[model samples]
Target: MSLPVPIDLHVRSYGRVRESDRHAYAQLVLPLDGAVALEIEGRERMLDPLQAAFIAPGATHSQYAEGLNRSFIVDVAPATLDPVVGDRLHERRFAPVGPEARKLVEFMRLLVERGAATPALVAGWAPLLLDTLALDAARPLSRLDALLARVEADPGAPWTAESMARCAGLSPSRLHALFREEHDTTPRAWLLQLRLARVCAWLGAAELPIAELALRAGFSDQSALTRAMRRSLGTTPAEFRRRRRT
Candidate 1:
């Protein structure tokens, strides 16, 4: 039988809860008003309003809250989270919750208050929330940071400044202006650089063929990948791979 999607959100006033054993699902604890002290994998940290702690599935951890601490406990199936997010969360125990995370937490609060958290809605929001949390944890301090993170996480995705703006909650014009001011380059150019970097990394690490590398690195085809490599790096994928091997 197929497993049910594990996604849940809880908002409550917390008290001192003792340490516990590992759980089967990953957990994220965000304090809205007060703080939570957490020990995950033998490392302890204080989780305040600006911070969140990610407990990996099957990780050993314990947590406690003093007095009346208002918090959000988000539980997600590791398999349900985005691959990059899941990997990153498993890599680290704590991260800062930026404006994007706050926004998501507020949305969850509203849904909980309205008694509108249907199963379908929870499932849909689970991935988005986790993605936002991961992005926030990466210190994406601005709209451009968010946009760049999205592109870097999925170089295979079809990206445009307009679509990126929508993702970053900004107008296309504004995104363009910020890119020019801060990066001195267009969004597409930055994306191309990310893609090329991905290609180069794979070329050095794996023995995959050029066509496979092209598809994996977000190029349309082998020819497209070759053209990009030639234009940007002054070498073809085959030549680059050969040099790396030698």
Candidate 2:
């Protein structure tokens, strides 16, 4: 199952209730102040202070907060952690809010409140946090950070498995195998997704001309950009720009 990529973080305080429910593309519930019970995969687990539960995109889960006062929900995409966390969405149920996790939580809140002021400039700290979590779990994918940095450096650049392999200091075949194990997709497809994500951010922030945006996103033309956008984002560039303006 694919996880929802987290673009931002949310913090909410709720009173005692029988059920606290939400459905998001991806979510991580971190209890900062109290204990609670969560039902995931038809099992219940208690979440103490600084404990966290991860929910895959659209995972059907409910929360029962026993005298809980506050919680932090950090949104992330499957692509963001899949390479490091592996495929199992509902992995281990309890992650201690270690110093690293706490720092990540604080950093995520700052980014969410400030928002990404510039297009194509994602808040880097979130991915770092995920990397740290993966490291703590001892399933580290060493090439992940370097690979993402290359993609972010130039999403418009023509990229291929060979190119990415060169970036990661691995052979093309080796890179492909690693990507399949870590990301469950080919390198080319992942690159396309990253480029499209940047395009989405650009469309949301500025009303750039379609042709220019397509070129900037490394597509052959506007039609290529439109088709890919529709496939990945469920809307045309025109519609996306319209919504952003509203």
Instruction: Please name the candidate that would achieve the greatest lDDT relative to the true structure.
Output: 1
TM-score of 2: 0.47
lDDT of 2 by residue, 1-246 (tens): 433444555566655665645464566676645566787767677765445677766667777765745676667765555643533335764454444555565444334434542222334655565555545544432455456544644678887778788888899998988878766888889878767766766776655698898889889899999999888879998998788667
Give the top-scoring candidate (TM-score).
1
- Write down the RMSD of all candidates, one decimal each: 16.6, 14.9
Give the C-alpha miss distance for residue 113 in model 2, angstroms: 12
TM-score against native, each model: 0.53, 0.47
Candidate 2, after superposition: displacement of residue 36 in Å? 41
lDDT of 1 by residue, 77-179 (tens): 7677666788787677787766556556656655654456677887787677778777766764555654564465467877777888899889988888888
lDDT of 2 at 85: 58
